[model samples]
Target: MDVISAVGAAIRTAFDMFWDVLWPLVLGFGLSGIVQALVSHKTMAKLLGDDSPRSLSLATLFGVASSSCSYAAVALARSIFRKGASFVSAMVFEIASTNLVIELGVILIVLLGWQFAASEFLGGIVMVILLALIFRVTLTPRLVSLAREHAERDAVGRMEGHATMDMSVQGGSFLSRLLSGRGFTSISHLFVMDWASVWVDVAGGFLIAGALAAWVPESFWQHLFLSGNPTLAKIEGPLVGPLVAIISFVCSVGNVPLAAVLWRGGISFGGVVSFIFADLIVLPVLDIYRRYYGGRVMLYIFATFYVTMAAAGYIVEIVFGALGIIPSNRAVGIITHGPSWNYTSILNIVALVVAAILLVRFLRTGGPAMLRMMSKPETSGEHDHQAIAMDRSIP
Candidate 1:
């Protein structure tokens, strides 16, 4: 194709990809908002306290049920961190939201392969544990103090997002809601929060993916990543793939396609997993960290995460290889269709529009006023274990 036609085609392709995820992003974000309402800062604070294994496990479980949006995950991480969660627990929440969600996992299997999905799942658990271990050893008292100072600063200067309406649950047994008895209004509140959290991440991811499709050459991907030299190939592949993914700024399941391309071009198994793990370190997420935490804390956390992800990837690759379960060879193309007009895309566009409207409204209303609009349930106790007030609007 001629240069002009090629560029034109690329633009259309980008648009098509964005179109495809637009609705899912919206629906996902709304659902995120809803879940946020159901989960109070008190509940989250209790479930993500310092030095408690129970807290960590609950945080992970909460994240899995939360939205699959990277932005939302970052937001939530920042919020919980500010609300007095230990750095490790906060990071666990971030990992679980990005990697352990149901929809994202299914999407990875559909677009990449079952193997990729499995790696992502197991790798995420390993990553959280590695991070916890790192923090336990390397995170000094100074670092903890520094994080707290930053968290306080962030709590004060935090920018407003769409705050979920406070959902009021009936004072009843758990079996009631689990069986057949949630109020309709409470359910709606849950839906709204869910949408708010996941959409922005999806939108940001799609925008980045589109830009890449429009400008980056497929061949360029092959050379930097793909290689057959075992030593140079092994570390280089994992390292470079994640580096590129970080700069590319896509995260969560949205990263699967680009990862698949890198793998197909001959990047190693470790490389693919590293790329997946690098989701939280992307530019936007880092920016969120800087905003929520201070520059020093952000730097420390970033360095820690980068090392932990790379190590986890290498370890998993070695273990899997030794076990003779390294998937024989790399999986091939799974993103069968390119950008096109479809029901999914149409839904995404509609969702985006709705999200935009809510964002505008939230901005105009301002954070405190918006929070006031969300009434709390009468006689609710203080958030568990928090030394400070926190915004639940975070991821």
Candidate 2:
């Protein structure tokens, strides 16, 4: 009974954290959907043709306007690669798509704090610049040829349909089109599809965070992070953070809540930053890279990406510290007891109603069929063709 009781408590804590951030997530994703729906993927491909500053900036803009689904980002990055975007350029876009998006910023603010959110943005920029520079220096012509060949041969990854869908409303000004029924339809599809891509990560994140928060002793984290010694902790935090993230297997916005847990438990500010950045390189994602871009290219990406993330975290920590902006108090802001009937409940009710309506629309509009086809391996060429046809037919 005690064990069951403890388990129940952990889940309850997890749900409370989810409840707190539920409304912000809905709002963020809703806005992300609208932005994604408005932009054409073809335009993005054109602007991302090279790894020059202009191209990298354009890539960042496109990434901010994209869905916050990491899988979708990977799929879209492959699409970028296939469209003749430089290899370094494609990676920069992938990094921005997952890390620099508006929804991620909003969720980070809500779960952690504004300072943390700011660090994420700053660190994200650092990561992108470093990724581009390092890849250019180290990437070989053979690796590029191999990756391009692999992309040409097999273009699909997780959330292929989600990345491929171009539901942007045509004609009229942006506002006018956004108010149209077709606009609403596009937003609904984007919302549901984006949610579908990352819901598992979100759920798993909350559960893992809750269990860790309830069961792990404070001393353990402090010891692991070397919190007793500030110098060592700062140095080691960025180094170890990614390892933890890789093993956690919870990436994307879902891991932010867990990051909050880590921060409160004595992780360095840099540690939190690197851990969040490491989501893209989680074990699952590394394997995805391997399959999508071939073994040698995947290894190259792994080394460069890991080094960049760690370096960015370390840099952010130093800058923020020198500026005296690092929050002195790191508190885990989860609800102690279960959530009460308050603003959260009210917002959740509204958000769920919206989600339900969108889900209904998704089902009625052939989303399930597309999802099934996209969920299959790259070998499913026939299904891919069918899914593409079906997507084209959608209004």
Candidate 3:
């Protein structure tokens, strides 16, 4: 009976956290869908063909405008790489898509604070710059060749279909295309597809966070984070942050809830930031990298990513500490709150209505079939053409 009660409490906490962020998630995804519906992957590929400053900048911008699903981001990065994007640029895009997205920032603001959200974006840029330098120095022509050769093979990874599907509406002014039937269908399709790609991770993150918040003693977290010694904690937080995240098996925006738990449990601000950035290096994503780029390149990526993620955490911690903006109060309300008549509830209601509308559009316009193909690997541009044809047929 005690265990059952505990489980229920954990689930309730998870639901509360989900409820708190529901509106931000919906708004972020809606905006992302609109961007995806307008931007062509072909244009992104063309712009990112080289590793110049321009290409890398464009990659970051494009990544911020894309889906925040870690799996989809990884798959799409590979697709762009195979389609003529420079290796460094592709990696930057992957990092930006997962770490610097709008949904992620909004969720952080809601759960942790605006400081955390700011740290995430700032640290993301630092990580990207660090990674680009590292790659420029260490990425060899032979390694690139090996990765390309492996990627060219018919190996499968999660969200391959999503990465390849291009539903961008074309052949009109921006406003005209956006107001067209094809535009609505395109946005709905991309929105649903993005949700499908990351729902499991998101759910898992909330559950784990809730469980940790409910069952784990504050003493345990304090000891694990070395909270007794401020100096040591600062040094260790950034270093160990990514290691914890690598084992968490949670990625994308899903990790934000867990991050809030960690912060409340006495983790340093830098630790929370680094943990969020390390989503790309989670065990499952590491395996995907191994499958997509062979073991050698995978190992190389893991090494570079770890160093940069940790470094970025350390830098952000120092910079933010100097600015005196790190929120001293670590209390997150969602962990203890239940359903109530409040602003959160009001926003969640509105969000659900928006979600329902998009979902209805998705169901009415052949979204189920598209979802079935989300995991299937793409072999050519045939899928994009077919998707565009289907969009034209809508309405």
TM match of model 3 to true structure: 0.96
- Each model's lDDT: 0.61, 0.82, 0.88
Worst 10 residues of 1 by lDDT: 381-390
Shift of residue 369 alpha carbon in model 2, Å: 3.9
For 1-395, candidate 1 gives per-residue lDDT tens digits of 67897667655655555444445545554555445434544467656778577877887887876656576566656666666677788888878887777656555554456776777788878888888887888888887787777666634221223221234343565445323223333333344444444445555555555445556675666566646466777778667766877887676666765665566566778888888888888887787677667788788878888887787778778877777776654534212256455666566577677766655434432333434422332113222211111122222
Give TM per candidate: 0.73, 0.92, 0.96
RMSD of each: 6.9, 2.8, 1.5
- The per-candidate count of clashes, in order, stands at 26, 0, 0
Ranking of models by lDDT: 3, 2, 1
In TM-score terms, candidate 1 sits at 0.73
Per-residue alpha-carbon lDDT of candidate 3 for residues 334-358, written as tens digits (9 for 90 to 100): 7866567888889889988988988
> Considering summed lDDT, which 10 consecutive residues are worst modelled in model 2?
381-390
Off by over 4 Å in 2: 335-338, 363-366, 376-395
Please name the candidate that would achieve the greatest lDDT relative to the true structure.
3
